[model samples]
Target: MDYDVIIAGGGPVGLMLAHELGLHGVSVAVLERLTEVDETIKAGAINVPTAEALDRRGLTPALKAAEERNRAEYLKFVRERFGESAGPPPPPVKFAGHFAGIWLLGDRVDENDPDLTARGSASLVSGVRQQDIEVLLEERVTALGGKILRGVEVTGIESHADGVTVRAGEHAYRCGWLVGCDGGRSLVRREAGFDFPGTPPEITGHQAIVEMEGHEQLSPGWNRTGTGVYVHGPIPGRILTVEYDGPPVDRDTPITAEELQASLRNVSGADVKVTGVRSATRFTDNARQATTYRLGRVLLAGDAAHVHSPFGGQGLNLGIGDAVNLGWKLAAVAQGRAGEALLDTYTAERHPIGAWVLDWTRAQVLLMRPEPRALAMRGIVSDLIDTVTGTTYFVKRISGVWQRYDLPGDHSLVGTIVPGLEFADGSRPADHLHDGRGVLFDLGAAPETGGRVRRVTAACPDRPDLGGLLVRPDGVVAWATDASGGESPERALDTWFPPDRR
Candidate 1:
């Protein structure tokens, strides 16, 4: 085998998975069609779960630096737009996120919510572009000694009982497992014969950064118009328009300045004339998901597994979650620490979340429709989103703090991402997970077991009732117990780590 794992597509998800696999000492390689990272404008920010995932990998400093840079750019944009009249930029508003076109103010978010508070520093959204994330992951992957082969497009695959052969033209690369992290139109998924079924697109959307005439005619921020929805600014010259006319006739064709101008006119009802386009892309509300994430030795993640509209900026976050969830499990299997049955859990856990994301984006598409009923519904949703409770609820959903896997064991924290609890030694749990191993936190008297799992004896003053926690490498609380009595970690340990069979 050329590698234990061969990842198709060197996008953010692929690189992240490569990093995880490499951290576990698994031989891995990432095949990317592009020689260099594309500067195409994609997701502009990451949700809380994604932030937490990066933090667990000890990439918090990088994330913070990127966030600060984005904040500075945003402040500059604000000052330029306000032009000295807005009183020193008003200290840069903390944005939580948005639902459809409705903005969820960060100030309105319930910070005291148990779920939000538990996430620690990861609770806030980080304004980092998709390109930046790919760069970061690529660096990490390279540092871990993972190979990234660029300009190698996967054309076909032949899956055997033990391994798979990936064909890129005349060359063949063999690996024990193959993961398709390619985009929505994935060749790996097609070759592997994964059933992709979902609703077709109803609306066409255009996002672009451009130089235009009469741009001031369009209002700033997300505006719901009679035609559709259009956003003017937050970033200078960045415009987004949605129209329920149908998906783009040809997505591959480059977006022309005239085309964007016409779209701006249609959605914003403004006489805006786009003079030049710096960058542009077309998208649709075409929601789809694989019937299952795996097909024998070949698996899927990121846009390969599921796809939906970019509503609420969920695409990157969803893809990041997929990488984080699949990475450790795949590493375990490749290293012979677990059986093939463990891979089944990947589909069981991620498929539902993928389905939810599809539905969530579909709902937003419904709200953004130009029809009368949709307008009424949009008004109602907007009203609901105005209240503090509504803002908090939307923040939870958009931030990904509400996601909890359906794992066994009745402990409340089970199946949830273990809180970023600070131990008595002043080190946090995330600090311990950087080595790519599961951790057993012994808050109270808990039996110590050895395998791949690391047991740490520490007291968490915040929750004295919590005796111990068995956290997976991916950060999910596999099992938990109270100081007095709770389910034993034997079941989870045996299920996930199992004594290494040498």
Candidate 2:
């Protein structure tokens, strides 16, 4: 079998990447080990940036609809036990970064301020389930002309000079480029000889979908204490979970009911009745990062590149970000629109951010550890919550807006995230970002692109911020400025597109 891009792992990030590229008419194949979407909804929510990424690609409506339906049924279930108010009623978040913030994301989210970014709320985020997200993405990808091959576990990958050859159960799939979203312990990364380095989880956790009567209120969307994380995501009838710092069990040991109840006692200070033990297994908050993200034609993403404590729920989200970053560049290179040099930027730009995410998750996990200094820091944080200033740094942890690599200082404005803007004609500047292409904002009357590059213009409050901003597929502003009728944006274009005037 031949393809443009073959994504190993049918998880959310791999599926999302496939859908994104398939929308652009890029041939993508998702090889997943699982046969069904199921109810292992570990990643329960997505943030503003990820939502916008989905929105730009036209998948937000299904997500919003699903959330709306889930909200009505969920609010009623909690109200009876927790009274009219459990903590803080959930907030209405309709803008870009809603789910990314923790406040409205949790059971009783902090709705102190809707306009100003809230640090506490950012940490309290909870919503969405992996199965639900995958179902939505699968339907979308198929509708947009993509292919998904299930029950195909990739056993090996051999990157030749021309492309990559993948072996999946007697199926030899060859592709120009390969993406590894296969989670931690990725077979592709191992085959490619990429090193995964970091500390293994100091604390182990067990996740389950147990049933408990009269304890519905006790099961908040997620409960965090010095011990670990307990997610109580409402899939209406069922509750899914991804936990850490769980039962006192050794590595690869089965979770015991006594351990779970004991941890519950420590965290909630109550003898929580445990029943209907659906699934239980111990997991450590091990933090790891791949030495390099790319090796020739093989690349790693999601849990493949970095696996950290799931405290921030960044495991799946960060992998999707990696997909969003690489899908286009691989497409561009395959189609010969850009040089191979563009591929180098994938690791250069994303690896650092991946490492940073691991570091932050490690810090959060450390606080959950049984260490004295860690407990002190955790107490410091708990007491300091009222001081909004003390919560500012964590806003990035929840919001995910702070995870970015260095940008060329030329357009200090360029390094920042490009706010989606509308032009006089009611056109969204982001609408033209598809089709495996780059966008150049031409402020001047006519662009002087020598034929190889394309330019379009849009205006907004900060449109005057630069001559014109050049944006790459991953939404990084390549170049821009006060249009001093000068040559920087054009120079930047040439830097990537080069002087190919055909």
Candidate 3:
């Protein structure tokens, strides 16, 4: 085999998986179609789960730097808009997120909530671009000794009992495993014959960074109008318009300035003229998910496994979640650390999340419609979103704090990302995950470390009742117990990190 794993896409998802595999000393290579990273206007921010994943990998410094840059840009915009009279730029409204253009204010969130209090640095959303995330992951992948073959579009795949053979143009590479992180129109998903099933597109949305005239005529921030929805100017020259006029005829066609102008006018009724478009993309609320994440040796992740509307900025975060969840499991299987059945859990755990995202986006689509019923529903939702309870509920869902896998054991922490527990030594659980190994946080006489699991004996002042925690490499809590007697870690270890399973 040319590599332990060959990833078909060098987007953030593929690069993240490559980093994970390389961390486990698995030989991996990423095959990307683009020669250079495109500056397309994509996801503008990442959610809590993605931020925590990166934090575990010791990428918080870079994330903070990116956040500062984004903050500076937002501050500049605020000053320009408010004429500098507004003191300190109002600290750039830390919003939880939005639903159907309805903003979820961060100030309204219940900070005492367990999910919110548990997340240390990842408690807030990070204002970083998807392009920035890809670049960061690409750098991390390379630094971890992973290869990235640019301009190598995977054309075909042949999955055998032993391994899979990937074909790209004139070359073929063999690997123990192949993951399709390729976008919505994934060639690997098609060649692997995974059944993709879901609803069709109903609305067409345009997001762009353009030089335009009459831009001021549009409302600032999210606006749900009688026609559709349009967002203007948090970032200079940035605009987004949504119209329930069906999907684009040809999504492959380039988005011209004229087309953008028409969309802006149709949605905002601003008569805006897009004089020059810097970057643009067309999207729709066409939601779909593969029946399974893996088909034999060929697996899928990111948009290859699922595709949904970019509303609420869920697509990028969902892809990152898929990559993180699948990365360690695939690496363990590829390196012969675990049985192949472990791969099945990837689909079992992620499929439900993907389905929920599709439903979430579909709900937003329903609310965003300009019809009377949708408008009435939107008003009720808006009212609910204004309250503290409503804000916290939506924030928890949007931030991914509400996500918990259905694993064995009745413990509350089981199947949830272990809270960012800071020990007596000032080191957190995330600090131990940098090496991509499972951790046994031995708070009160936990079991000894297995070959693949690292044991960290530390005193947590806050949660003294927490006896110990068995954390998977991906940060999910497999088993946890308080000071009193509960389920032992042996079963969880045997299931997730069995010693020398071949």
Off by over 4 Å in 1: 84-95, 106-108
TM per candidate: 0.97, 0.83, 0.97
lDDT over C-alpha atoms for residue 339 of model 1: 85
lDDT of 1: 0.87
Candidates' C-alpha lDDT: 0.87, 0.65, 0.88
lDDT per residue, candidate 1, 447-498, as tens digits? Answer: 6665457788898998888899999988899999899966678888888887
Query: What TM-score would candidate 2 get against the native?
Result: 0.83
Residue 485 of model 3, lDDT score: 53
lDDT of 2 by residue, 263-353 (tens): 5556555456676566554455678889888888888888989887666667767887888888776766766666788789888888877
Write one digit per residue (lDDT tens) for candidate 3, span 1-502.
9999999999888988999898989999999999989899898898888998998998888888898898777766666556677444334333366888888876788878877787876556489988888889888889889999999999999999999999999999999999999999999999999999999998889999999877668777898878899888677788898998889999999899999999889888887788999999999988999999998899999999999999888999999999889888888899898899999999999999999999999999999899999988989999999999999988889888889899999899999998988889999999999988889989985867555587888999988889999999889999999977577788899889988766
Q: Which residue pairs show collisions in model 3?
A: none
Task: List, in order, the clash count of every candidate structure.
Answer: 0, 17, 0
Q: What does the lDDT read for residue 248 in candidate 3?
A: 90
Error of 3 at 94 (Å): 5.6
Better of 2 and 3 by TM-score: 3
